[model samples]
Target: METSLEEDSRTKEFDGVIFGASDQVFSRYEDSSTEVTYTYILQTAGEFGCFQRILVALTFIPNILSAFFMLGGTFMLKMQPHHCNTDWLLAIQPNLTMSQLFNLTLPRKKDGSFEECRMYTPVQWDFDSIVKYGLNDTQDCQNGWFYLSHEWSLITEFDLVCNKASERLRAYCIFVAGLFCGSLLVGTLCDRIGRYKSILLMLMFYAVFGLGAAFVPTFSIYQMFQFGIGIAIMGYTISSISLVIEWLVSSRRVHAIVLAQCFLVLGHLVLSVLSASIPHWRLLHLVGSIPVIFLVSYIWLLPESPLWLMMRGNVEKAKFLLCRAASINKRIIPPELLQKLTNEKIHQGTIMDILKSPNLRRRTLILSYVWLCIGLGYVGLSSQLHKFPINMNGSHLAFRLVEVPARLCSIISMEKLGRRKSQVLALLLGGLTCLYSAFIPEDLTSITTTLALMGQIGLSAAFTIACIFSAELFPTGLRQVGLSFVSLSYSIGVIGTLLIESLDHDHPETFMTVCGIMTTVGGLLCILLPKG
Candidate 1:
């Protein structure tokens, strides 16, 4: 049934919008209409009191756990110390020690690290003839490699170095591809299923695929698992974020977004520490999957988004969620008030709805460009964190651990500066810092590292605010689709990680400068979006 708001909307002369806006942005300001109307859940129901605080926590904590799985592939696939086994030399001389066997079979680099891919060809089996030759003639490793560590990685197990070195990077790319495919499916599907159920399903699959990857007998099987985890990771993230967003007042929206990010970074820190301490890569994968399984019980605690339930014309379901929220917050919603609740009269959204409108299309296009830029810039900066100067163990962990506060600061700036201004500030500053950091001399490592961290702070804040603002641009029905669409740019940005690494081999600054330029362009385009 249409609400009193819909009946009122019909009676009044509508102006300025035709396609649609999300419930949050679906405002009509008419010259003849001196009176105002509010039919949104936030208007009738409570926001930002104890109920919403609890809502945001429940939705975001699972999202944080999902972040742990996102980077598991990176650590699990890491290159370990390895070299040609050179077992043939043992057959020739069984008495030789391992160090002696290596010195006789492998060539040394300038600083004395053994060449991993090459071994000296043996012309004679006798020790005297071998000593006379002095290890000159070399051939690529014919025998399999012997990894230094007791634990095995994809690199060590598959011999992913040298000829197969490029293959090692494939897992990261495939993981991202899985994310893209998931984003494509989730936005529409989650909109069909309620957010609460969708998240539970995602968590279930996240655990399933993560465990499968941990014990897969072959790389092909592992790839299948990695792809599914990608879908689960992104589906849980966007849906949870959208779920929390629908519950908040505009002022609390910033906190909701950044606080979730803080959890994600915290999860990353925990994953890094776990990976470092774990003896086996498979064990690390198992560890990453376990926490998500434990978190699945949160389904009973989480509520479906009332705003979404209402948008889908499920008024009864919406009422149930609202009443539950009110009771949990120690407040009461009178039955009479809920009796007034009604769904807005709007057509269901599809991808065509986004493309068919001129104003929305323009705004979505601009936001999309910024999303792509933000994605690339963020990934580019992250790819460089290992270069940061530090004397401590787990220095990469230290670099990531500090991002929590950077995300926290966005809560203040997002409100104070407003969405558009903060985005512009972050993008501009982040781009400039990345450009400058790229040129700093290696000798000035501390100074250069500081510049990168500053870049992360700016870019991270920009990325966070950009998402909240993007959701605001679309109506509830298409908000997930819109978020998913724009976030595909982020998946596309994962390619930048590969590009930067490839370019790092020769023209190190090329990709960094490219990231700077992209972000700068994005900041300029973000100015064209309506201020949220």
Candidate 2:
């Protein structure tokens, strides 16, 4: 009996050892599985992080290039001579036809001995002498002791005045119409289509219209081209701004847009040099078109906005694109995170939706007024570059240079201080300066000039702030629409140019009254806008 009991105990001990060994092996296997899973997760995360970085790089490079192209022409236009070139005269003249002679005719004497024969028959005739002596002599001789040709002078004066007035009217009309249509058209289109498509379309329009403007022969044709250019500008400006804001994380959006405007100033500076060098308006237009061609190459490079795609119910496509972006930026997006991103709700908005929402309606109204103010203060002021007391080209260059630092200051302040405070202060100060400009004594015109400079600085800052703040107010879905609407307000501001242009510089009050009212009204409206 004792031997049997001892055998049972030995068997139990062996069984216990086998059970312990099996359990130990299973625990080791489980740990190895967990280690493998962790390694895979780390690797995936690193890849996604890299993808995100790539997306940012891809988005930023094109935007920089686009900004360069859009502002290039305007800068060039501002820098070119306000007066017509005399170079054309050197090519054809002095081989006069009867018609040409009639075009250049002096009056006939009653005795037909060339009323003042000495003036008509030059002593030393070169091209320079002909220009200096011929036209002046002919007009003067015709005026005195001859047929009054009051009819001719009246016709010539009427024609010259009519042509100039038409040109000015056309420029302002195109600018205003383009601003309005661009905002409305681009805003609506971007909502229906995607951001990428809208951009591509706008770029095409820019390239085509820009080229057309460069080559058009008639003033009427040129006005049409300007209208086209305006449309293209409005479309691209609103969409590009909205896209940039949407793509960046909230913390960085305002700084990015402000910095982008700084690049715009840089573009203006570059254009100033190009305009000074090129001299021909057509060539300047051609230069603007060249940069836009690069945008086509980005067709494969740029991705559609994931948020936009998602809102449109393109979940799978959005996921794929987002994954690709994440891959490019090298962000490690995990399966669970990807799932969460896919499940997230997106607002698929319409224009009616924008109008219907009370919050948005109020926001839109304030933004429109702000837009008007910007158009008036910024565009109105900038457009008067030609009318400045200094050389037009020199003033343009100076203004471009000043804008650079002002934009830089705006960027720094926007980040450090926030959008509302910066804009309100800037606009109010700018308006007050404009008002005070009215009171500046003519003898102290130098002081007025100095104050004008100060006002410019403030106005530039205010403009920059307005763009930054407007961009921040809307959600991604309505961002483009919001910007477009705001852009329309800018068009309304262009009317101020007509008002400015009508003012006689000698009566500084005319300029002061209009500008002061605009700046002050703009500043006041800005106060009501929501703090972004």
Candidate 3:
């Protein structure tokens, strides 16, 4: 039997007793069972009322802070221009001008620039003997390197140069590895402990670990803190999105998600400004994390998802929250409706439930792969922004600004073209643009950068569309687990991007080709998903 919304009727019998639309209740009965969905109850709660707005504002502020954890590495890990530390020459000759010091102490490159990794062997001699002998003996850098730029970044402070240059890439991988581990662990944690609690816990973890990363005495400790921060971030992301979706009605979900993403983009832009203003990596890390420490106040102001409570069989708490929502929404929930909720039963979701159903299993696999591809493209492109012809800061800002229009376009496309078609189109656009850019000569910086940014627009939009689509595709019971798998796949892609980036310095074409193929294939796979 089917139940349809009827404005004229207050009660209906569809082979069994059911409520009307005005009650914001819909019930179905089969031989021995009565079923109710949270969606029906959420309608009465006033989806986007003041309560939801406040929740969104409180929950998403951390997303702005996420920008620091996510992209701050680009600025903080950068290696500035440097040459071997030749201060030894000063001890031998007190009056050697800086020019003469470099001319004798370091070897020159073909372009007449001093070699960054090599210095002339030191030999004790008077000033006139050194001038007559013309010290030409060359050897590897004997002491630490001297940075031409004053920026105090990870590279400069840690001396991650020459033999240690590869360590920088390793640190990046460690951070991404944390994201992967965190996604899987926290994804389950949120489902088990409840979204609100999970969020609060992760917020504390993120702030603590983030601040620790700034003050760590060694590179290894810093890496450990980075991993912890990554886990916290993934936990926060999964919990917040789940909470927001559970709170809002279906009609307003897209708006809420896109709005949150807008906040994230805003964070990225602000991060660019902050990076420029604060060149020291430690200070930057400290500044970025201190604000999040204050957000712990969300414990008092924010409410747990009523739907999660109901799912957990805490009917009383769910009811109280819903009643509060109704009061705030300026709506009423009848005693009968409340009674119906009390009688409702929901099974806790588990990984097995996702695999037990063929439809769900198929959707999960497809969504995971699609998310992986989107992650690969988005992260790869963003990481390469510095390689463009423009200065690093300008390119970073440009890349983030491009996301604003891309996200708006995603919203419009989701509205006009529908989710499936819009996502497919976006992915294909990104892949095809990247393919073209791959063959373009490196000297054509203008054309290459233009193409990369165009591809970013497509990938960025695809990412936003995919987030909403994945959430809707999974059943409410399995949403957390399903999204966890999807997020896990995205983490894999991000890790893949980091590994691929190491090869990028030597094989640029290979990097672009792989991204293009992954994205294009991901778009095509979406066709396999069931239509909305």
lDDT of 3 at 306: 78
Evaluation by TM-score, superior candidate among 1 and 2: 1
Separate clash counts for every candidate? 1, 20, 0
Q: Model 2 clash tally?
A: 20
Each model's lDDT comes to 0.73, 0.59, 0.80
The regions of model 2 sitting more than 4 angstroms off are 1-162, 343-345, 442-445, 504-508
lDDT order of candidates, top first = 3, 1, 2
Q: Pick the candidate with the highest TM-score.
A: 3
Q: Give the Cα-based TM-score of candidate 3 against the true structure.
A: 0.91
Q: TM-score of each candidate?
A: 0.89, 0.72, 0.91
Residues 224-271, candidate 2, lDDT per residue (tens digit)? 766777777778777666665445544455566666677677666666
lDDT of 1 by residue, 358-455 (tens): 66678888888888887787776666655666522265576676677777777677657667787898889888888887788778988887887778
Per-residue lDDT over 374-408 for candidate 3, one digit per residue giving the tens place of the 0 to 100 score: 87889889889778988888999999999998998
lDDT of 3: 0.80
Regions of model 3 farther than 4 Å from truth = 1-37, 110-112
Rate residue 374 of model 2 by lDDT. Answer: 64
RMSD of 3: 6.3
Model 3 has a clash total of: 0
Show model 1 residue runs off by greater than 4 Å: 1-45, 94-99, 108-113, 149-151, 343-345, 391-393
